[model samples]
Target: MSRYETRLEDYRRRERPSYRVFEGMQELVCSVGQLHNNWLYVNVDQWDQDPVHTPIYYLDEHWLEECAEDGTAATNEQDEYIPLWISDRQVQTWFELATFESVVEVLKAAGKPVTLQMVIVAVKYYDKRDAYLDYDEVKAVTDLWFVLTKVRNHLTE
Candidate 1:
């Protein structure tokens, strides 16, 4: 099986191992809830009350090596990469994009019109959900909004 499949199986069995977050400062103890858009939906026990999606890159070799050296890493022979933690910055970006995508999907499913206001609300919700917003997250939301706005305008026209 591929590394991704092995991780998925681990998640299904609720076997979450600890991994290091950004700069190896914090550890994330979580299980995989789902996968979407090539990202992992994880249920972090340390911070979030709910599951959150993060980029798969958090499990890349470099981060894993740092975690291993610190004795905070968790993996097995069947695993190629194990994601143990997510940085504050990564969480923000992931939350923003994932929430926005979810909102869009819900609107589509309900056959409701996707408006600028809806997208704006999604971004605002994420901004307020966290204690503080990172500058990179702010930029990411703004950039996504710009692109969405263009798409919306084009579709309407």
Candidate 2:
């Protein structure tokens, strides 16, 4: 069987009920681009094996601990940039959920210029760590801030 076929069969067999928005939806996943319009993808095997696909964590270390309480975890190492893979649908949700206050708050929390590139990176990587973010405290602003932290971490500056 083809890998896709095998994975589909596996999905059928798992028999668990969860709202994994991107579960088995590999095609919708792509690298968090430097700009909102940008994107990248590769063979699933490459994503599984390549260190380059890891997120450049941009949050303060303490918030990672905070996020752990909310069930998101992350791993990364300094390397050439390719960007962490995330779900486009989840990103769209972030923007749809966004309010003007949310956007301003996220940008302020970033504690820098919060340029267009940074906002793009935040959107693309918003769902990198989980199938969906489950915590009530995680507003659009908070989620954006989390990924922005990843963007900041990844930037060489």
Candidate 3:
């Protein structure tokens, strides 16, 4: 194959990312030093090189869709790069990356709509439901959820 054809073949055969990539990705994108670590966390080969900036355009969006609690596809069309494309398992493996502040930043960065309700959902789903947080962490989520619910009700009513 010619050089261009070889590159095209490689791109067509791209593999799905592994769990470790999601783990590293969440850690890298978390609040600690996140501003400078927005690049892709790891290569498929799991190397420890500098951050790579490969957009997942080659991946199937359906394969990447977020699922409901019962495992059905959550179909409102998340429409943001991270929320729409990351797998449910990836979200479960994610930690600090799903906080309300980080979520706001993600939405804003993607130029997607950000709403208080959506923030509440992100906290509930990613932090409370998906992550394996401890008692104190769960309590923190409860507190945040309580306050956010009150605020949303007050604003909407």
Candidate 4:
């Protein structure tokens, strides 16, 4: 049997009642149905006959501790207990560039004029970690101040 078939068979034999799966920003309460390459087939909707194949990397741990601490837990449309799946990438983008003052200071030290567009572009560039950040393609603002601080510290050392 192929690797996919082997994994699917193994999943079938497992006695676990439920599995928590994530797809990008959404969390899914599911049961393992099959495993193909880097994806795991999950049955998300009991009424639906088809299962969704999600990337294995998106599998997340349950939120038992978080629920206990907060006294609240996430649930699906069916009111089934589920954990919230917050995207690492989204968190990195959202609150990463909260402070622009520090970034302005770094730019001043580098002899670069502090302009609104320049700061915006710089934030985008740092967020992507890409060699080239096209003006039209900048999707998120990253924490450039954090990166600049690290680079400055390294140079001084």
Instruction: Report the number of the highest-TM-score candidate.
Output: 1
In order, candidate lDDTs are: 0.41, 0.35, 0.38, 0.36
The full ranking of all candidates by lDDT, starting with the best, is 1, 3, 4, 2
Specify the highest-lDDT model's number.
1
Candidate 1: tens digits of C-alpha lDDT, residues 1-157: 9999996675576422332232211111121122222323232332243222222232334546777778665553334334334332223223322343454454345454434444444434554684333344444676787899999999999
lDDT of 4 by residue, 56-119 (tens): 2322224334563575545444443333452221211121111222333344455533444444
Model 1 — TM-score against the truth? 0.24
lDDT of 1: 0.41
**How good is model 4 by TM-score?**
0.23
- Please give the clash total of every predicted structure, in order: 1, 4, 0, 0
Say which prediction, candidate 1 or candidate 3, comes out ahead on lDDT: 1
**Structure candidate 1, residue pairs in collision:** 19-84
The regions of model 4 sitting more than 4 angstroms off are 1-68, 72-103, 111-113, 130-157
Worst 10 residues of 3 by lDDT: 48-57
Model 1 spans > 4 angstroms off? 1-97, 130-157
